[model samples]
Structures are given as structure tokens and as C-alpha cells.
Target chain A: MTHTSSSGTVRKGGTAKRNGRGLTGLLLVSAPVALLGWLIIYPIFNAVARTLFTAGDEGLHFSLDTYQRFFTDGYALNNLWLTLWVTAVCAACLMAICLPLALYLRFAKSRVAAVVQGLALFPMFVPSVILAYALIRTIGPNGGVDLVLNAVGLPKINSPYLTPWGPVIGLVWDNIPLTTLMLVAGLGGVSDNAVEAARDAGARRFALLRYIILPQIGNAMLVVLSFTVLGIFSAFTLPYVLGPASPEMMGPFMQRTFSQLSDSRMAVTQAVITFAICACFGAFYVRSIAKNREARR
Target chain B: MTAHLSRRGLLRAAAASSITLAMPRIAFAADGFVNVYTGSDSNISDFWTNVILPGFHETHADAKVRVVDAGDGAGLRAIADRAMAALGTDNDPQVDLLEAFVPDETEGSIEAGLWVNFTEAGLAGLDMVNPAARQTDFDLPYRGSQVLLAYDATRVSAEEAPKTWDELTAWIHANPGQFIYNRPDKGGSGGNFVRRAIHEANGRDPRKFTLDNYSEAYAAETLPGAWDILKGLAPSLYEGGAYSSGNTQSIQLLSQGVVTMTPVWSDQVLQALSMGVLPETTGLVQLQDLALCGGFSRITVPTNARNLDVAMQLVTYVLSKEVQSKIITELGGFPGVSWDHVDPALRAKYADVIPATIPTFPAGDWDAAINDGWYRNVAPGIARS
Candidate 1:
């Protein structure tokens, strides 16, 4: 007890000074924070400013006409809603799929478990553009699935390509590796002894998961949900290739508006709106981190 | 995100330094050098490299010609913008020549003052050039292409194909799920298809709209009718109003037997056929009453080009009977000079696809507006179900 107390005392005060706790911490954080402000934050504010203010006959007049049009326009609204819907669906699906996979990877120590983890993480290596095209060839209409099915005497299948669900499938597939990684890292907190104790207390799979696993991994779940939302919301390539043409996702919509329509202001407005929504999703992760810090203190 | 950003930053820095390093190596030779800029595809570039360069080098042994392909006109646009910026200034524009782009005066605006006036310049081969193909004195029209209907002959007979816009609309209604066009913004075939539709709706007069006549009010009055025509045919498109995402996709759909007919560029379809990407049974036909839009690939010499004399000599050579025949035979395009000047065999071979007239479309503001408007109004008519 005396030895432990002395070691703890050494870690608390003397070590805290030697570690990057005060001026060193401030210096380290300031550089990145300042760079981020210059690169990211400044551009975001500038985009918002440009969208709201324009050069007209009156000279730098402020008008919400573009915003009004974006809000009122059915096409723009459809794109926004589609983006939102796809993000929500992708986030939910990621949680449902990844949570279980994470639990299995945590408990199952069999050699087969290593293979499963490798397969799940495979998408992390594949680029998103390649993944989209690979998905199209693998499951799209008149593609490999049809060829195999026809050989087996089955009816021609409806393809997900050029549909709203197309981006969702590609996104979920591309996202599995990261989501599973985060979730598995979260599952690390669920100690084997605790899980075993809960099970011996007559807690079945559901109860054990509900009480022990869920509580231990709440922060990880929050991180995954927030990240999935943020990642899927701003995704461009997959949706551009796989999604429908009309009610498309915001990423492609902004791009088409900027390059195709030759309207940079409109595109910037769409971008600002996209990031604004994503920033709200980011609040969840920030809050979870803060809560963990407070609990530690 | 940080890793991706840092890697991208490093790549951009490397690219900038490399481009700077290569900048000085561009031909600064006082004579016997001309850098030709082209926005054409690899096939056309290959023709320029293998056929045009070698032939020109044979005539002028000491001549050094470099053909640089600026993809999809972006590099051309940037060069033009740079030249325009350097106007009345001493900055070296560094560009020698542009192919497939024209520098001419817009009506009621300041004179372009960009290209050398070839008509007044009196090049040696001017007399042999076809009068009808010449767009303006600013441009030397060397080759031409048109948008035509590409159909699968396996399912569609030659007689069954429509020869006019109205007939085509009827054919689409009759053969539902067999016809599709790409999105107007994404592909030229779809853009030309929509262009012909606009012409058909507005009293069937291609002359009502001009390159200089576009205004907000004029478009407001003229575009609604066109939208109505496009929307009317929406339900009859492939997969119940589904539009292909691009020109290549539209052709891909036809090759996959998903659609029977699609609007395709003449040169692209010819190249694809030669490469055996498209089936042997694919047939092409141009509308008779009012053909879809096509343009002559005009070669322009910037008035301030470093190699103006050599460029003009090259132009005269390009306008020769020999090179014009190569334009038709080797390049799969129509000759700038009349069909009479080209080899009889090549002219006869292209009889079916030779356009009656190359109708032009307004490109500056009209293209973007038409594409955007289609997305807003006509695209919504496509039933997702």
C-alpha cells in the first residue's frame, strides 16, 4: 500500500510537470489549431460570406435570393433530402452490422476469427472509386450476378445501380472496415471477467450485452455513429457513380452545380449547408469525449 | 483525413515543381518549330503524331512540330484565358496553335481580335477549301463530325428507323423501353438530342436562336416549349424515363442490348466499331429535315503566335487535297474541302453519314442553362418507379 501510494504521488505531480501538461501542451495544440483555422475554418466562413453577399448594381449587396431558391427549388431539396436519408440509413446499418462483428471479434479467438477480421477489414485497402465500379460489375444489372443466375435458370434480377439504394450499398461496404475497427476497439473495454460474472449471474446473451457490453462501449458507439454520419454525408464518388441522376446526393449535386452548371456561388452554398449539418453530427463525438474527460476527473 | 490531406499536399507540391521544371523546355527555337495544341482524343492525337507529323516532316525536313493534347478543352480554355489576359501586355502567351477551337467575334460585341484572318491572309490552299464548311475568316476548318442516331440493327431494321425528329418521337412512343439518351449536361449526344428537340418545338426553325441572341427573357419564352417536348417523351425512355448518366453509358446501354437506339457522336461510334467494342450490327443514320448539331474542327492561329509563318504554311498543307483525304479516310471525319476534292472511294464510303448541314448550337451561356434547366424541369418527369 505504501509503495503504491508513493508511485501514485510521483505520477500525479512531478510527472505531470515533465509531461506536456501546460505550456508544451498549449504550444503543440496552437500550431495545428492555427493551421486548421487558416485552411479549414477560414474557407468555411468565406464560403458562407460569398453565398450571402454578391456584387450587383448596388455594389456588394446582401441578398438571400440564392438561399431562397435553394430552399424553394424542388430539385435542390430532393438532393439534400436524399443525402440526409442516405447518411442516416448508412449510419444505422453500420451500427447494426459492426456492433455484432465487433462483439464476435472480441470473444472468438479461433483461427477462423482471424480470417473473418481480415475479410471485414479488406475494404479499408480498396479505394472508394474502385469499390464503386467493382460493386457495379459484381451486382449491377446484366453483370456477374445475372450471368450466374441465368446459368442456374433464375429470372433476371433488378439492379441497384442508378437507384437511391446504390450509394447506400457501396457506402456500407466501403465503411465496414473503419466502423468495425472503431467498434472492436470499443469492445476492448468489455473485460472477460465482467462478462463471465454477468453470465454466471444467469444473464443470457441479451442481458449481458444490454448491461455489460453496452455500458462499456457507449462512447465507442457514439464515435462510430458521429463519424459514419459525417463520412457518408460528404461522400462524392460512390453516389456520383452508383446513385440515380435526378434526386442525387449533395456531393455530386454541388459538383454538378459548380462545374456542369457553371455556378460556383450555388455550389458553395450547397457545400456550406452540407458541412453545417455535418458539424452538428460532429457535436456528438465532441460531447462524448468531453463527458469521458469529466468522468475521469 | 490528415493523412490524405498531407499526401495530397505533397503530390500537389511535386506536380507544381515538375511543371515549373518542364516549362522552359517548350520550343523556344526562332524558326522551324511550331507547337500544335489539340483537345482531340487519343485516336486524333495518334493521327496527328503518326500521319500528320511524319508527312509534314517529309516536306520540310528541318521542321519540328509538337502536338500536345489538352484534354477535353480544359487546357485550351486555360491557354485562351491566359492569352486574353496577356493582351496588350508583353507577357509571352507561349501557345502556338489551337485545333478544334475558333476565335471569332460575337455579334454586337467587341471584335475577338484573337485569330489571324485567314481569308485576308491568302493561304495557298484557300481556293480549294469548301465555302460552306468555313465558319469564319478567323478559323481554318480542317475536319468535321456530327451527332447521329446509333441503333442496334439486330432488333431495329434500317427502314424502321426514324429519319426526322417528329418520326423519332413517334418511334420512341411505339418502342417503349428501347430508346434512351444520356443526361444533357453529362454527354454531347444527349445535349445534341435535347438541342434538336428545342429546334423542333420552337416552330422547327433552327435559325430562331443564334449564338448572339441568348437573353434571359428570350430563354424564358423559348425553353418552356422545349421542356414540354422532352417531358412528353419521358415515359417512353428506357426503363421508364431513366436517362443514362453519360454519352459512353448511353452507347454502353445499346451495346449491352438494354436499349436499341441512342444518340452518339459519329467519330466515337466509328472508333468504337473499329475497336470492336460495339457489335457489327450497330447502324447509324442522321435526321434529314433538321440534322442534330455538328461542328467543323477548326484550326486557329493566334495572331501573336511565335511561329505564325510556319503555322500558316502548315495550315496551307493541312488544307491540301492530300491531308483533307486523310481527314476523311484515316480520321473517320468529313473533309474541310468539298467531297469532290476528297478521294471518290472515301466520299462514297461516307455517303450515308454525311450531314446535309452542320447546325451549330450556342455554347457560351446557353449550354449550361439548357443543361441546368433540363435537370430542374424535364428530369422530374422521369418516374422513379
Candidate 2:
């Protein structure tokens, strides 16, 4: 009977230890989970809720008026179209620029590659506002570019920095550091042995890039694409300072609705629309991450 | 309990007494300080800190002033949103005073009952305020600015500058890519220019449009002409009619000699002159027979202000002749008071630029409608051309 009591006590002690660990684990995670809900998730849910319902003469009521207004307005529709085009173009440009740069930095055994890599990442340190003003000074009419052109007896160029191209160029410049970094990390995951084997088997540069490197960095490209799309879609300062006033980007349009027009409901609705569009890319990002994790498992 | 206190209990009592003693100092610190949320630039803040605060402290020895830079119009809107959110809640509105540009910017907040009625509140300096400066019973105007054409004198002589709306259009046609104005939606100066053109296009009296009520019928009638006029000039604007995005951008274009002339705020031109953004030869001119939109910056005590009395005191101090003169001399802002009340020297200094007769902004809704119309009809039409 004493031996039975001792064994039972041991089991009880074990259960208590497990319970304690479970409680500790819950406590550890609960704070961060609650914080995340409070900061990010709650605000998003609130914005969506606010967009769905609006206050009226009677009280809170279900309304699609804000969304209706956003869609019906031709200028707002143009803004959305412009935003999507700019974001897509910027994403394509970023990939074209950063992908090759990343691969070169990874494979090349030279100081020039290192210096080029460092210079490519330099924009990360410059603030968007500073970069915008610097761009203005560098490429604005009769600016540095004009001065150089004039010195060489060429006609001064009208600033493309003030047009749609301005925001595209600015967004690409600002995003290169992040995209290059991600691609570099992704290129690291591509095995050098595989490349050597491909080369030995008479694979040309283009063929090696197409079959080996591209497939290896697919996940990284998706990540870069998702973030670049999202960033450019919601970009404010760069576009506001660089782009035109009318047919504005979504970021400035939503800002104008909220602040200048004092139409919070409409602004929230615009935000919801932007989120819905971005969610398509975000879903792809989630699936890619999950696939990456599953493949690792 | 005190009579029968143990050593621990006595020590606790002593510590509580010390804290109790320090409470008044903390309360005094809180009460003596007035928090002002202003959309004014660093120049205004510097003046407030160096001149206004010192002047106020001399009179009221215990008073302390804290100026919060709430940024430009967009920043002020964020503050307004916060203030609106905290309304009727248990939350203490940490803001006391709000500084805003007249008409459109401040109108929404006033309509929402955020600002206290100055007449009801019986604020000081009400009698001293100029009739022209008073936007409404509630809005207490502090400093004034008018929209005018700022030109690079080196590029265009004073005689060569356009004196009327028709002449301005003619000049633009004569000198394509030599003049620019920002999009009307972005800045008050640009908006004023657009409003003036709208008024001119319809051949209506400026005073009729400046009324307190906005008529949709009037706007609908006037806007077509306005769009036509804007489109007509589009071919001659900077870069074959691509406008700069904002007032400052237009100024930058003018200063860089990219464009010879642009509409800019009177005070901004002066400020830019001092900053060397514009050359010494830069000149400002008001259109002949066409009144530019002139309005004042207003100071209001918020309804839920923590320091209402102190805010009122500051407002009164700001409106004083000495302070107004300092505003003119130091900050290059026109006084809230009438010209006669201003110091002769300061008035003479700005006489050439400051128009004697300036048109007030139309009702808030009308101003907003004009901006929307410009963006929708004029901007797009310009783009197409």
C-alpha cells in the first residue's frame, strides 16, 4: 500500500509540473498575442467595421454609401488604377534591377561587386523625404542633370521627376535595398555545387539562371513582390512630393479624403478597398511562406 | 491610529506627509502651464518663445507657456480628429488653444462644436480686433495673409508683370512655359487664384460669392467657365502646362527661374525672401480690379480645454498692438488689427505688397466645391489638352 501511495504521488507531481509548464507557456505567449491583437488586428477590424457601418440621422446603420461614393467618383477610380499600375511597374522594375544585382554579388569574387552591393543598399539609410528632395535637386528642371546636359551643349530636359515616372523611380530607388537584401539571402539558399554541376554539364549563363537560380529564388521573389506591391500601393510621402496633385495615388487620395475633406467614413472605405486589393498579393505571400515551411518539414 | 502608531506605521505616515507636501508643487506646475497646439512654422514658434512668452510672463509672473508644433494643415486635421474622438469622454483634452488658417481649415472644427464661442466666452481684445479680420463671432483672427503674384524681377520686370486677369492670361500666352500655379486643391494661394478666376469667368461680383451661404446653382453655373479658362491657359503653363503640386512647389519653381511668376501667400514671400529662397529682386503684385483672397489665422480656445483661462489670456496677449507689431516686424505676418492700429513703420514696410482692399474667402462649402471642381474638371481638362 505504501508503494502504491508513492507511485500515485509521483504521478500527481508529474501532472502538476506539466500544468505549471503549460501555464508558463500560456503566460509567455499571451502578452505578445494580446499586444498584436490590440495594436494591429484590432485597428484593422475597427477600420473594416467602421467602413461597413456609418452613423446617420437616426443612429448607426448598415451602409454602402461610402464605398458607392468611392467607386462612382471617376477621380477616385483613376487614383486606384494609377496606384495599381505604379505598384506593378515598380515591382517589375525592382525585380529586373535587384535580381541580377543580387546574383552578381553572390557569385562574383571581386571588390567591385562588394562596392556595388554596398552602393545598392545605400538608399536604405536615406529617409524618403530626404531622398525626394535630393531627387528634386538632382533631376528637377535646370537641376544637376540639366546643368550637366547644358554643359555638354544638349537641351535641358523637362523633369520626369514631376510626372508619374517620378514616384515609380523614387519607389524603385527606395525599395532596391530591401529587395536586394531579400534576394541576396535567397541566392544564399541556392547551392554553389548545383551551379558548378550545371556549368560542367555545359549549361550556359541564361540556361543556368532559368533552370537552377530562378526556381531556387521563387519564394524570395514572391516575398519581394508582395512587399514591394504593398509598399508602393500605400506609399505617401514619395508620391505626394513627387507625383501630380490630381489623379493622385491611393495613399494621398485617402489622406485628402480623411484630412482635407474631413470625410473619415470615405477614407476608411478607400483604405478597405486598398486592403482588399493588397490581400490578393498577401494571400500568395502566405501560401508561399507555408509551402517553404512545409518543404523544410 | 496615529496615537497608537507602530514604528512602521509612523514611517508610512511620515512618507505620506512628504508626498502630500509635494502635491501642491505638482498641481501648481500643471496649472501654471498652458499648452498651445499651433500649426504655425518654426518662425512663429521662435517668436512665441522669445517675444510673446516673455511679454506674457512679465505681466503674469506665475504663468508658463508650452507651444506644441502640430505641423501644417494635415497635421492640424489629425489633432482635430483626436479632439473630436475625446469629446464627451472621460479623457481630458490635453489641448488648450488651436491655431488654424481661416475659412476652410477651421470651419469644420467650428461646425462640430470643438471651439468655444469667443463672444460667449467674453475673450479679451475682441474690441481691438479689426472688423475685416473677424471671420465669425467664434473665430478670433490673429494674423492675416493675402494671395498675390510673386515674380522673379530679374526674369520679368515690374511693368512686364500682369496687372489683371485678362492680362495674366495674355502674358501666359505670350510666354509659354514661363509661368505656373499649383493645383487649386493643394494650397490656399492656388485655391484663391482659382476662385478669382471662377468669379471672373462667370462675370459675377466677388462680394456675392464671398457671402456666408454657398449656392450649388451658382457653383454649377460658374464652374464651366472656370474650367474653360483653366484649359485655355494650360498650353502656356510650365512644362507645357503641368502644374507644380503645391504652393511651395510653385515658389520653388519661381525661385529656380523655371517659371517667372506664380501665386504665393504674401507672408510666405516675405519669409522666403528672408531665407534667400527668393532673390532680393523678387516682387509681389495684386491683380488690378481683381481682389485676391485675404484671410487671417485664427486662435480658438477648445471647448474641452484644460487651461481655458490661460488660453484666453494668451489670445488677448497675441492680439495686443505691441505683439501685433512684433508679428509684422519679426515674423512678417500682417497684424490681426486694422492698418490704422498697426505701428506706422511696420505698415509702411509692407504697404507696397499688402493690398488695402482684399476679398474674403467664400463660405466653406463653396471653397471646397471650387477645389473639387478644379480637380475634377480643370485638372483633367488641362491634362487632356
Q: Which candidate is the best by TM-score?
A: 2
When candidate 1 is compared with the true two-chain complex, its DockQ is: 0.26
Cand. 2 Cα-lDDT: 0.81
Expressed as tens digits, the lDDT of each residue in B1-385 for candidate 1 is 6666777799999989998887767635443468788877677888888888888878878777888887544456666666666556776666677887666322211264667888788878777777887767877888887889999998889998899988999999999989988888776789899999889878778788876788989999999899999999988987677777777767777877778899998877887888887989999888989899877888878777777787888888888788888877677777888788878887788787666678877676787679888988888785584
For candidate 2, list the clashing residue pairs, or say none: none
Model 2 stretches astray by more than 4 angstroms: A1-26, A54-63, B1-33, B40-51, B54-62, B74-90, B101-124, B348-354, B382-385
Q: Against the true structure, what is each candidate's TM-score? A: 0.82, 0.87
Candidate 1 residue lDDT tens string, A66-167: 889899988899889989899989988888898899899999999999999999999999999888778767787677888899999998788887788889
